[model samples]
Target: MHVPDGFINAPVSVAAGVVAAGAVAVSLRGARRELDEATAPLAGLVAAFIFAVQMLNFPVAAGTSGHLLGGALAAILVGPYTGVLCISVVLLMQGILFADGGLTALGVNITVMGVVTVVVAYALFRGLVKVLPRKRGSVTVASFAAALISVPAAACVFTAIYAIGGTTDVPVGKVLTAMVGVHVLIGIGEAVITMLTVGAVVAVRPDLVYGARGLAAPLKLRVGGELVDAPAARPVPVAARSPRAVWATGLVTALVLAGFVSFYASASPDGLEKVAADKGIDKNVEEHAAKDSPLADYGVKDITDARISGGLAGVIGVGVTVVAGTGIFWSVRRRRTTDAAPTHVPESV
Candidate 1:
């Protein structure tokens, strides 16, 4: 949920901003270990894909809709640290470019949506994968459960934050109940989307899916009625097993989803918006600072055709987000390489 400005007071919002800043800082360091030559670029595409899928909000209740939060999907595909960065990038883009989330409340949004979701989902996913059968299918199953749980977990976090700094005097219990209830329905959609996306990636390139790595059991061969461990398989050549194909396919899919499919997304308000309106949480909500931007509200300024305007905005968002995310991840990957490089010391002459 994109928390608009004025929903939280200045002091609490600033405190949340510090917390968000610290999280991003820690994740940046952790991401150094997660990013690699193949994954660094792939991570960018994942961010873009999440940005696109989030546009296709599905109906959750009579007046509430939900979209992919992308934390579990990202963590499963890449890693948790990188997943947090991915969501942060998407949230930053949406707030500044689309005027969807509040600039002032950016920290609150990141803490609740990016940090909390990624941490909770990834931790649960790891636990489930450990106990479940170590098969590809198990990863997908775990992804579904993790994603389903993450949504409500995020809702609870938001409720807690609101309880502390909510602008209105609404009953905290009521807010918690409504928020958790609607988000539970939303979580199912999140689970399905995460499961399908993770399954698809794991099928095509398990190596690219961080959670699926090391999941395949050693090959066994029957030798005169006795099963023995098979010889180790040779590593595939880098050229022969490139991630370009997967990257291109993912980018194309993202383009299709955001550029065209988003037109059919439910027009109803999302879970948070619905809850806020119902509970008077928006009584003090302020207008977005970027509301006048050309691409504000996911539409191009002065574009009469709704389809064309929205399509252009979506395409632009995908392009910008991919570029920005790739740059950040590639830099992180480079830093990791530098850190791992051997340093030489000259002998005393």
Candidate 2:
């Protein structure tokens, strides 16, 4: 959920900001090991795709809708540290460019939607994969289960944050119950989307799926009536396609989803909005600082046709987010490469 300004007081907001900053810092360091030549570009595409899919909000309960939080999907497809950065990029873009989330509450949104979701979902996903059958299908199952739990976990975190710094006086227990209840329904949608997306990626390129790496069943050999590890298989040379092809395909898909498909998203309030209204959480909500921008509210300024305005805005958002995300990841990859480069010492004369 995109928390708007005035929902939390200044002190708590600043505290969340510090927490968000620390999380991003830690993720940056961890991402160095996660992003390589094959996966670094995919990370950017993942961010753009998440930004696109989030635009297509599906109906959850009566008069309520929800969209992909992208933490599980990203973590399963990419890596957890990179997943956090991906979502944080999307939230930043939405807040500054689309005015979808408030600038003042950026930290709150990042903490709930980015850090908490990624941490909880990825941890659960790893655990489930370990216990479940080590197959491609198991990865999808784990992705679903992880995503399902992450949404409610995020809701609980938000509720706790609100309890501490909520602008309005309301029954914390009621808010917690309602938030968890509605998000559970929303979680179903999240699980399905995550499973389908992760499954698709695993089918095409399991190597690219961070969670699916090294999941192939180990080879076994029988020696002296006992089972033992077999020698490593020879590397097979398949007709390899360039990563550019995959990146191009992913970018095209993102554009299609955001540019046209988003037009059909449900108009009802999302889980967060509905709960906020029901619990009086929006009583002190303030206007977004970027509300008057040209691309504010996901529409181009002075554009009469709703379809064209929204379509242009969506396309622009995808373009900008992809570029920004790619730049960030490329720099991270470069830093990693530079760090890994060998350093030579001068010979003693």
Candidate 3:
């Protein structure tokens, strides 16, 4: 959920800011290892895709809808560290460009929406992959389960944060109950989206899926009525299938989702808003910082037509987020280069 400015007190807000900053810093280093020519570009596309899918909010319960949080999806599609950055980038873009989330509460939003979700979801994902049957479908199953757990985990974290720094004096127990209960339903949507998306990607390019790496079981063959593992069979990465083609396809998919499909998103309150209203958590909700910007509220300034304004905003957001995400990931790839620089052995040798 995108926390508003006044929802949390200044001290707690700033503390969360520090926590968010530290998380980003750690992710930056860890992402370096995961970012390369093969994966760096995917990172940008993943962020843009998450931004797009988040626009298509599906109805969860009465008066409540939910959207892809993208922590599990991104972690499965890309890597966990990059997944954190991906969600963080989306949160930043939504706050600054769309005026959906507040600038002052950026840290709170990232902590709950990015860091917590990625950490919790990735952990569950890895655990499930280990215990479940090591098949392509298992990855989808793990992605679903992990994403399901992550949403409620994030809700619990928010309840705790509110308990400590909530501006209003709502009953913490009530808030917790409402938050967890509603988000559990929301989590199902998250799981389905995650599973379908991961399954689709794996079907096309399993290598692009970070969690699918090293999951290639030895090929089994029937030799003279005996079932035996083939000695020549080897893991084939999605990149080996066609790296450029995969990147192009991913970019196209991202654009389609953001440019056109997002326009028809359900216009209803999301899980957080519904819960907040029901539990009296909105009493201290503050305004967004960029609420008056030209593109504020996901509308282009000076555009009268709702479709055109929203479409342009969505397009601009996708373009800007992809560019910004690509920049971050490209820099990560470059760091990987510098970290493993070839030792000097000039022609003089």
What is the TM-score of each predicted model, taking all chains together? 0.98, 0.96, 0.94
Off by over 4 Å in 3: 221-229, 232-240, 345-349
- Candidate with maximal TM-score: 1
Comparing 1 with 2 on TM-score, the higher-scoring candidate is: 1
After superposition on all C-alphas, the RMSD of every candidate to the true structure, in Å, is 1.1, 1.7, 2.2
Q: What is the lDDT of candidate 3?
A: 0.88
Q: Where does candidate 2 stray beyond 4 Å?
A: 221-230, 235-241
Candidate 1 lDDT score at position 340: 92
| Residue pairs with clashing backbones, model 1 | none
Ranking according to TM-score, highest score first: 1, 2, 3
Relative to the true structure, how large is the alpha-carbon lDDT of every model?
0.94, 0.92, 0.88
Off by over 4 Å in 1: 223-226, 347-349
Please, what are the lDDT tens digits per residue for candidate 1 over residues 1-349?
8899999989899999999999999999999999888899999999999999999999999978999899989988999999999999999999999998899999999999999999999999999999998789999999999999999999999999999999999999999999999999999999999999999988989989999888888989999999999999999887787899999999999998999999899999999999999999999999999999999999999999999999889999999999999999999999999999999898899
- lDDT by residue (tens digit), candidate 2, 33-148: 99988788889999999999999999988899999899889888889999999999999999999999878889999999999999999999999889998889999999999999
